[model samples]
Target chain A: MTHHAPTNIPTTGPDDLVVRGAHVLDPSSGLDGVMDVRISGGRIAEVSENLKGLRNIEADGLHLFPGFVDVHAHWRTPGREDEETIETGSAAAAAGGFTSVVMMPNTDPVIDRPVVVSGLVRRVEGESRVRAYVSAALHEGLKGERLTEMRLMKEAGAFCVSDDGLGTQSSGVLRNAMLYAKDSGMPVILHCEDHTLATGVVHDGAAAALAGLPGSPGSAEDVATATALVLAAETGAKVHVTHVSTALSAALVGFFKGSVPAADVTADTTPHHLTLIDELVQSLEGMYRVNPPLRPEGDRLGVGEALRDGILDFVATDHAPHASEEKYLPLEEAAPGFLGHETAFSALFTELVLGGSLTLSRLVGAMSSAPGRWVGDGAGRIEAGAPADLALVDLSEEWTVRADGLLSLSGNSPYLGRNLKGRVVGTMVGGELVQDRTGARFGSRA
Target chain B: MPARNLLTLEGTSRADLREVLDLARDYASGTVDRPLAGKIVCLAFFEASTRTAVSFELAARRAGADVISLSERGSSIQKGEGLIDTIVTLDSLGADAIVLRHPAAGAARLAALHTEAAVINAGDGRGQHPTQALLDLHALSGHLGGFDELEGRKVAVVGDVVHSRVARSIIPAFRAAGMELAIVAPQTLLPLDAGAWGLPVLPSVDDAVDWGADVLYALRLQKERMTGGSPRVPSVPEYARFYGVARRHLAGGAVVMHPGPVNRGVEVAGDVVLDASSLIPDQVASGVAVRSAVLALSMDVARSRVAA
Candidate 1:
């Protein structure tokens, strides 16, 4: 592994190591108990009680799980690097216990062509602290008019195809894209929002009403979800809705998942959608402004129920980052997006699983095996011969989220000043202790 | 219970509204004078307005506060200065209270966050027009006997409720004043979340009159925005026929009101602005007294903060 230090922090070389006296959890392997795990040469060497290694780190009173797989995060590389880069985003992801994350294709030029996909893959291999996968735009330049060359993008190492920020409006255009995606076996990730219905910046409910801002009705997501699911079912293409914010959208996904198993349709909810309600958007600063905006309590609790009932497949932070000045503008003028990659797991674990809205196993599964399989990555599991991607978390630790303390360059987060319960103490990617309790730094070059 | 900034009436307590209303009553009766002397009030109107802007200036001047007016086109705002920059500049230039009227819903709150000056929303876009609602309260109170009489009274707010900042603010203010409120507008003019207001949505001005509403508060037609291509209203005549308030719709002893720049024939019947039962002028006259109370109320916060 090679390294690039964007921030001043000491980096240690790869070595045979053991994490002992910790609860090892992996939903994929059905392993949940106190154990010792050994890693060497970027691979898991052993997993059992009382294993010895050259160097051992005490992990007692900690819960160890497979490094989380996040399928939606905007690294903003190739352009918008001032907001985020693959290196900085990967470090932030690692800090948040995400060993692998799929980057969105909503960059300046957008990752539609094979060249961009290959370039991103090379950069991720060279500079990233954790594994990075790039999703290519379904339409060329994400214009929603012309289909991109899917086979070439896939060959160039694009994990999926998406027109994330812009929904493909024309049904014919979307149908063709789904057909091509089916042929290429690339999952079509939909940013489900009907632009005409999504007129405002906030949810169409009590919050927007009381705030007196224009309302983006829940029907926006419901309409788009229906459109995409119909296309996915028609073309037999694998479709995944990113950031499902409405109960109706979740119900549609649930219906499709239960009724049409061959459609290969799945959806992931964001931490902001799963935990925070639209009421929070009324009080918080422009940091809570986001696309497919924060929904009311009905949708918030609805998505929670969807997650518990297997209607929603997993959790992924739509970790969109914007420049501070852009976010500091008034609610209507400010650019939409906020910091999420660094706070996703902690916020979810604290608000959902620990708060009794979700079980520990389900949350781990959503973050790990489910999203891992969505991207076709052989990660999100802990077993001998499997990749040594892991996170050691102190569930009882209470810490307030602060901008000055986060690793991401962008500090826009609704969770600012909010005290959360779970903390990621350490993250190991490919047998390398990339981050620990001391704080995040670049990983090894060995 | 004084508001730190009058952003919305949603979280405002009854005590806070009462304090301002009582002071406004004193101003209306000419019993209060120069309460805000030695204070500085900056009126920053980023959107075009006449009544809200002029009344705030008059109120501040009458209260003996040094007042500065900043309009969007005439100021550095036209030279591309940001809202926060303009607010902070006013704060640094010694504004004790900032009266802002911008076209964004949360503009006043955003300004409040960036400046130490007391921020007041004169009228934010489709957001709360707190002082407008306050003056409306003053006028309605005088016409309906007293504040005590407001408890059982019914006010039907007709016309463009969706785009009316006045409507948004008045809904909660009137509700807090113990008045039963009903809305009469075309479905197009109603906000998608209008149900959240918890007010009865009446079919038309006629139904509201038939229902024996004591007051008919009409909002601006906003026809220029509401009646273009893909118009919210099909035609001006159609909307006027359905939601508009004519003289005949006014029941005996019933009053008519408009936050002015009223589309004379559209939202109200012709010559109805000067009708015996029309409280339109009284609403405008009440603006001076109510705003004087608002200026003093907001500056009291700044004064106490400095003293402490």
Candidate 2:
């Protein structure tokens, strides 16, 4: 079986332009410092000082980096369009400087069948502004019962298979799915959670106890992660654990990555998990509720350290969107997720980069090239002959995250009302300026 | 500043507790006045309850307030109406005080955000039952002669303390009232990092007695805890042998109190439930007076009366 790299369907044709004198930073290509990047036919034609093109846009003060690739996001398409549609989800992704986003298969009708995968791919092509890849479900209806037609789904343009929003409960079932996924050459993205131990709404810790909210222990995520890592090592299957919230789970991934070198086991922690703690639940806001619930301060620090140390592979937004009605209720009754896409970068830049714990180079790499490599095809770098998917950020610009200012249909971000540093002023997907907040002028073809 | 609502006793001050308990004492001594007259007090219970609902309703009526009761059985909540919508509806209907009992933690806080009315949390899942804590304090204080008499008193909270809103509310409230507290439960039944609460976790009810506990506060043990797929306790009889407060444990001049509807043979022995030393009935009686004071204070009625 052959595996195809996920495709991006840009609305406009590739631009013939040069981004002049921008402080370009691409960690993957080791390209740092001010450079003029010329784009031709949606590919980076050259990267050097004083590069000339048909049209030029001056970007002297901006910091340019490869557009972020989110390995995990939920568009909530086809079913809860009110919550988030492909158009809006992609818009939110673009607003956050994400040029490529892999949508989870937990949508209505469940992206389990080949038809669903193909249909979603087509919809994303027509509706999405960025390069949106479709991830088919590993289990039928995400019930953890039977396996989906992974080989057929890959044939239909599915980049990967996942049962996100729910974990595959039985180890035997997960092992079989992994084996089948290996045969299909599809990366299995897992939402690791042992349901029996994940019975509570918030993290099982001092915060949850004080808040009087039911606490779901971190062991839930840790146990499932261990199982998946063991199975991945045993089967040699490509496994990506999404939303690794617990410290032990991140350590387990590190252990497997070190000990079982041949095992293709990668993991990601959400921006919320890295920055926020379970103590936020003390406010009793339902918006704080999330799957593999927000953990203690130590877990947050550990996860952040793991991401910095490359123990955790990269960051994924788990960009779940829900109507305000779903989020404004009590913690137990509210839906467990946060609108993650738009706030991912700024929240990280402010909390980690500026906080002196993590470097901007490492942060950019994790958000861009690191996750970009997982999606394949040299997608997340600004080197020549690479896709011109890029973002122009103003690192010094500070803005408060207001609910009404959000691009996603849902305004349930934990960062809402908090002032954050750094802003993605411009985002380009396939040489097209899908989001141009910088208001820079492009000269006519010369 | 006096609190406008009684959500939880976690941050409540000694002065606030003293004011409420003192007013409750006056209320018990037949100080009858229409403190809540002409005010619309809405009792919105989305969960099942017997004593809390009845006591709150009775308290509002005795305080001369116009009561509007809404339970899940007969209310719009039964039709999948969310707690926020119900709270909004009550607020729109001129509810001056919204007494909420919901199965979701933080329900009252969520309700309070949407309404101008004062919010009193009757019970919100395992979140808090502040009034119950206050009433337990009132009963303990009254039985021991006065509030000052509760100083340096040791109270042992036994049973499903993790799932008990009563335990959640009382632990803080009692501690603030100068009562030393210890938790008595198996490891499985305690909250995560129970040590963070700064209270000792006694191994057994007998150990609690040996620790010189003046009051054995038995929390109601749900039968589902034992019979559920992941049983918290090994068996009912086994749980009784350890955490359960029997007559023998209370023989050291220690009073037995329960946030009632107790399991006869589980958390407390059948004989000890109505034993001479049992303050269970007094706890029930204190509910009305304490809730009356809570309603009056939350509505600012007691403030005006005290000033007068």
Candidate 3:
């Protein structure tokens, strides 16, 4: 019943391992050629053609890229662990070839104070298999009210600030937040929604009209994007608009990319928004109900183009997990979001890159180097001095996505029954093998 | 085709609809009896309902099925029991059929996924009420001579089209019978993408009357659609002046219909509700026979499955 093919690494294995004969695709180094990589002391020891070591891992006919980094993800820790705990979420990320993920701050008490941020960081260190970073809420309770202690949160190891599940509706509060985030050297992740125009359960178009449900217009996102761009421009903050859904939002993000400094204004799109469209809501199923709900085909194509043209900076999973009971409720009552961390790369590689809409380098850039730059971690590169965070994928492997096969507590992925190309067969974080799909070596008890 | 669960009227074939209406006629004329005698029917009303609740209880008993009534106020649901838990409990108690009404859209469909009992949707908030649409069809057939005569005829659905599950169900049900629909409502009450429906849109009731609408299906105007309401249409008197079906509009020989509990002076005049041309009473009467036919059809399917 497991999607992984029963490969394992020893529990107390040494970091002196070598990967042989694999096509290494590193966006940071522009090295899209076959090479052997040697991992020692939790870093890349060598990247030559004939690297030799005591324990050699054979990897012929595979593409090795940097492990994925997601900047906008909802792991729902500290509360709502029944949906996804920190360890389970990190395990899912490791299985999906993600080495580092920034968790959203919309949990039970909401990750607002420095105490909460520090506590989560310690918990992640003790329990998580992958590097899990926390993002603090910009407001005290994510109420869009008073600001939290941004500098204190940054000191406590929070890399970003966001009121992700809730929108920062007040421009005064948002402007002040950007100003403070710029001072603290932390990026501000905007959810980008105008509540006044966001009353609809579905996209404010043919889907909503046909179902007789309330409609949320594309203009809602456009209005919010324009507001955030103006604020980013005003405060000179590193503003990253997360889950950009509308074409107009993508256009606004594109228009602001070069107008401001490269890092000052950036945006990202999710895997679901780039592939699915508003028409999916016709099913009246809860799986299709996402915030900034899936827009029209034009918007889907627009974000795809944005990623290709570098208008959008990277891809984040927004991997919100909910109990099946919560997600399987009526469409109106069901919570929004899909299981993303486990299926993001496979779906995008099959539908966008291999389908001819995007290049493999561009896909890797969005999934790896770009998000790594957003997090400013030494995680998205393959160099002699860089961390040994890597993913070995079989581009020719074709597999169908199944809910039960995932490692997450909830299985609400939009690509649940899809046949996708490009399966990640192995993953390593900090010179430690976390996932091995070969089912033959080292911890192969199964 | 007759689906195992009657969640919505969409995609139902003309023959299946005719079968329901014909069976209803038999029940109304006292020809069919005790078809569901040994069956156990559970009436689970998670929302407040009058006609649908009472009629379904009477229908189940008249067909000789033992009935159990559960409402949100008195049942465990009031103590915060979930809908799925309640449905599973009823299924464990050997319920052969479950008639459900809830305030949330798609409740019946969700229940159908949880249990094997023949699920019937009495009403599911602004989503669908298949039985209501069937009863309305039965009453309309009686008024227009027969169901066959419904072909090429025009029926105008007026007021609050967006919030009306009745409209959602009736539109497809009537379309299946070869009947054309003229949906009349203010732009506020109409769905924002009504053009996609491919039905004729009449902005006012007078326009539908002039278009020779054979039946006026008036929906209730929930005081909110008035001037100060959420969607913010014109005032109550202004709505009555334009979209409401008054006594004067009834002079055009078009039959008036209301899914009862009507807004007397808002959507339809009080006198027009009980006028000689009103099918409101007959629509109420048709609810019982139509529900009985539905129960019988579902029980037949369940019995056949068990035998197989």
Candidate 4:
């Protein structure tokens, strides 16, 4: 078998991240044109046709687009560098065209209070080239009880309140959190996996029985999702799903699209979930393993189809990272979730875009503006007053995902060495160069 | 017609019939990412297989479709996820094809049940592994120029025949291809229906060897499969002394073949698999490719009728 092809990087000058020539695409602004954006003092000065005394660069072979915003990303700070420090995670985000990411509060010391949220935000700001936002926990410690001080955390710079690593089963607790969230004017992004049906591993199906592992059935996610929706509708708070990996959950998203006010309920599916399942996970050993574990291949395709049909909200890399030594066990024993930040867009492009399941505009909308609208983030559109958060992608470059040399700290991407037909060549955050071909100019690898 | 590859024997004209030769070629040469796109397969294996079962499962998945492996271990036959209930369950679950491996002969045909999906016989106890037999035929054709021309060619299948399911299945397939088979085992080892299988039976491997054997297949002891013991070989050492393929015997380019999990020296030398004429690896490789095509074809047949 062939190892993944070496990443073919363009031999170009390394100044600031600039793409002067490619067609710009921003679905939120109805923008599609050959535009030029000028970066100065780490902010967009202008986006016009031509300008003298500017750093003249070539972007003829690519497509300029708004930087993707992953509202739900499990980006740990340098505090625990072994399990995805901020630098490594930010590098992954940059490679995926994500200039801004709202990290989930599921670290060792879960970010619940203003102090924790502020600490994480400042840590990421000081360490990462890519912009980082904090989505602190709703409950004090994510113990499934007692609402955290949502207002104080938001004022202290928490982007949103989310109990994402797990969901609270008690309706009273959820209702209180959403009620608090409604008051705070922020959404509660929930990880819709019911603990009652949570088997600590994967979906209980034919594959689970054959492998003799515990099953994390679809009913679990469905129940939690329904409960969250019921609470959201009652409290009038926005509820979003972090990483949806099942068809049963996807059908609920379809219901959301047609449901009244179309749910303020948004959901995102990971590229790993969109591409693989329990059977493939079993074949690849525990390497194919992930939480909300890869549902079967049927569900994988269903999640992709739902995204294409506008039933699913967006695509996010619940890019949880773990040390390499942790995955040396069977399906049930190994840790769940795969690192997918770097290969996110490429895998989606291969499965949905190249397979003709999703159009390019749809892909851009789901990856960028959709999440932007859901989180109320400033990143996504390329309108005149918008921040210069952007990405330059070459849609025709056929890149291969090689695990051994992957940028993410964890080598858990299921698409390792899978053929992909597109690549993000350059990424910009506030018009400053976060990542490009030469090397990261912010942190050591950021 | 797009030339549907029929997995069943019924309603298959010679024109519709996919020749064993063509199936082998398609498997060997063709490649597709989503060969079974928008499809689902209900895999029913009555018996267990670690290698073959998992291989076929991987093949179906690699073709990009859904696969529902029915739980038959804790099944209540009719009241349970038995053969029929399992098929019905798959139908309700929107399965587009079925890969059936049963202990009963002709189970693949019986399980088709009028759905549009192709019912592929992964293997049926002693009924047939048509794909395996076809692969065998293709191997023999390559070695001896063609099955039609193997009029005088001799094959030595030693040890057990009475309890060997492979012997029963390959007999008809070989007969269909017009190749004469030489059953080389003792009277205790030979099945009473051996002549009814329409082949000349011999008393020992030496008979075919003396008659200039073109191929040798040393059968597995099959201890796990045997419910009761029949004296096929007086002793394993005795059988090996008389019929076991030695290195010197296969030096003349005569091939050695076995289904697998070869019992090192009891049946044949350890070096036999690596010998220039062994067909073992090629046979193993074909299991995946042929199953992929069969899986894809089955799905295409069922896709139109199975609903979202």
| CAPRI docking class of candidate 3 | acceptable
Measured with C-alpha atoms, the lDDT of residue B278 in candidate 2 is 94
Higher-scoring candidate on TM-score, 3 or 4: 3
The value of fnat for model 4 is: 0.00
Q: Rank the candidate models, highest DockQ first.
A: 2, 1, 3, 4
Docking class for model 4 is incorrect
- Model 1 is docked with a DockQ of 0.54
RMSD of 2: 1.8
Question: TM-score of A-chain in each prediction?
Answer: 0.94, 0.97, 0.95, 0.89
Residue B233, model 3: Cα distance from true site in angstroms: 2.0
In DockQ, how does model 2 score against the reference complex?
0.75
Name the TM-score of candidate 1. Answer: 0.92
Find the candidate with the highest lDDT and give its number. Answer: 2
Cα deviation at B218, candidate 2, in Å, is: 0.6
Worst 10 residues of 2 chain B by lDDT: B1-10
Which candidate number would show the highest TM-score if scored against the true structure? 2
Against the true structure, what is each candidate's TM-score? 0.92, 0.97, 0.93, 0.57
Backbone clash pairs for candidate 1 read none
Give each prediction's DockQ, rounded to 2 decimals. 0.54, 0.75, 0.43, 0.02
Q: What is the C-alpha RMSD of each candidate to the true structure, in Å?
A: 4.3, 1.8, 4.8, 21.0
